[model samples]
Target: MHKKFMYICFMSNSKLYKGSLTTIILKLLNENDKMYGYEITQKVKALTKGQLKITEGALYPALHKLEAEGLLSVEVKKVDNRLRKYYKITENGEKETTNKLDELAEYIKTMQALVNPKLA
Candidate 1:
């Protein structure tokens, strides 16, 4: 079935994003002004068409690390009687996003050359 194929493909591809997770978060935050943890997860899922899922265990630590690194800032507010934390990219984060994106682009090119040398 198509669903089973997609599931298998997604499972294999999931590990590809591990090194780029922070860059992914930074790029997403750069595109959007601010996002809560769950919002970021949903956005990634929607954008990837369910191929990639960001787990809470992985997501929270990255957010915390970015915050500590001075690249992202957080705000807390109450919504629907529940407190929610929102993350916003700092000015430095925008710069880092650009840098990471450039690096990723180059990495992709290198991978392409190696993976499909005829195309390269």
Candidate 2:
């Protein structure tokens, strides 16, 4: 029973992180002009105190998808003989971020109301 409960908790947390990946990336770019993949992953882990972590496998795919979608622009830089891709938000990305955030906020409020009717 305990193992099942733990597994469910882990899955739930992973789903939340996956759902927020786009928002996380956009918000990070919004705060800074640009950031490399590793930096973005570390920032999210630090900001969430390790509660939220982005696996490279998942992060790269999302970044690539965002780039393909025209929401992100990338610049490559050489550091220590290795190339790093730094991402920044485009103008359209900035506008989209604002709209998405508002929608997420409303969704959160509605969920909270459902969870705790008195709080709403």
Candidate 3:
């Protein structure tokens, strides 16, 4: 039963990602000057009260993809005797983030109307 529940949760999260993971990541970076990979995952989990978790398996790839697209800039810094890579939004990333946020808002509004239509 626990496995079943976990599977259901995975399915739902998978659907969420199908729509908004990239936009969500961009939004986070837009709010902050810079963030590291692990920091991003922990911040997201805390903000969502553990409802949403971005595993490293998924997150690193997304970060790499964003960096490749020139939407994110990467910097490596030495922290606690180890190198940590941080990501910051570029000028293009800021513009892209704004556009993506607008698109996501429209999507949410559409979903709300479909899920609970209001009588006019």
Candidate 4:
């Protein structure tokens, strides 16, 4: 029963993270030196206790967009005879991560005030 409840909660969290996916990715990469696509997805799920999973379809596109915007730089390295692309945050990406985090924080504060006004 507890596992079932956790599964339901995880589904809801997945929906919420979709909109904030890029911000989450930027923050994660900021903390780590570099990460591959699959590594990023696994880290997010692990950190969120399986509540959040970044789909590959969603992740690759966001990485490409950030790279195009100069917010990220990618390096390709061969491991086990296969090439893997690792992403690292750029100087601009660090600055953008700060701004994005501040924006999200403000939004959360506004949401708290509105969702539970008595606590505000």
Candidate 5:
């Protein structure tokens, strides 16, 4: 019973975080200029009160895809005998972030209307 409950919670939380992954990454980079993988993950967890957790598998692919699309740029740095890749939003990324945020806000408003028609 406990395992099943845990699984359900995990799935629900994953859904929420997955939808906001791009927004989260963009906002983080916008605030900090750049961040490494672990830093980004930790920041999201902390800021969201552990509600939003980013897995390595999900994060790396998203970061790589963003880099490939020229929305983000990366810098590799040596830290404590290991190389860490830090990501920063490019100019295109900054503009894209604004657009995405606007679209997301509109989506939320639409969802709210569907959920509670009187509120719309």
Candidate 6:
């Protein structure tokens, strides 16, 4: 029963995680100073212990949207004869990161209450 519950939670996580992608990216940039697209993907996987994977299809669009919103600034540099774009959280982004993280925390608390009221 415990293993089955764990499996179910992990499966649900994939769909739930998509909604928090923007916040996840912002939080990572806030901590790392700057990161490239692929680096961000790898970091999420590592941090989640291989449970979570961020695909390029989802990541690039979120990065573009955040850049467009002025929450992120990008710098392109040549590395190993290839151009790589690094994303850094802007001043606005730093502020937004705090807001988003707080919001996510509250959401998690609410979810806990709903899913397992005894835990709350």
Backbone clashes under 3 angstroms, per model: 0, 0, 0, 0, 0, 0
The better-scoring model by lDDT among 1 and 3 is 1
| Candidate 1 overall lDDT versus native | 0.88
Candidate models: Cα lDDT each: 0.88, 0.83, 0.84, 0.84, 0.81, 0.88
In Å, residue 79's CA in model 5 sits off its true spot by 0.9
| Alpha-carbon RMSD of each model | 5.6, 6.1, 4.8, 5.8, 4.8, 7.7
lDDT of 6 by residue, 18-41 (tens): 578898999999999999998988
Model 5, 1-120: lDDT tens digits are 356445322313334445677877887887799999989888887887977677766788889988898989999999999889999999999998998889789989999999999989
- Clashing pairs in model 4, backbone N/Cα/C closer than 3 A: none
For candidate 4, lDDT tens digit of each residue in 39-110?
Answer: 987888889788676666678899999999999999999999988999999999999999999989998889
lDDT of 3 by residue, 1-120 (tens): 356445322213456667567887899999999999989988888888877877666788999999999999999999999889999999999999999999988888888888889821
Consecutive 10-residue window with the lowest summed lDDT within model 6 = 5-14
lDDT of 5 at 68: 92
Tens-digit per-residue lDDT, 18-49, candidate 1:
67889989999999999999898889889988
Model 1: lDDT of residue 44: 89
Clash pairs for candidate 2: none
- Model 1 / residue 13 / CA error / Å: 5.2
Q: Which 10-residue window of candidate 1 scores lowest in summed lDDT?
A: 4-13
Q: What is the lDDT of residue 43 in candidate 3?
A: 87
Query: Can you tell me which runs of candidate 6 are displaced by over 4 Å?
Result: 1-13
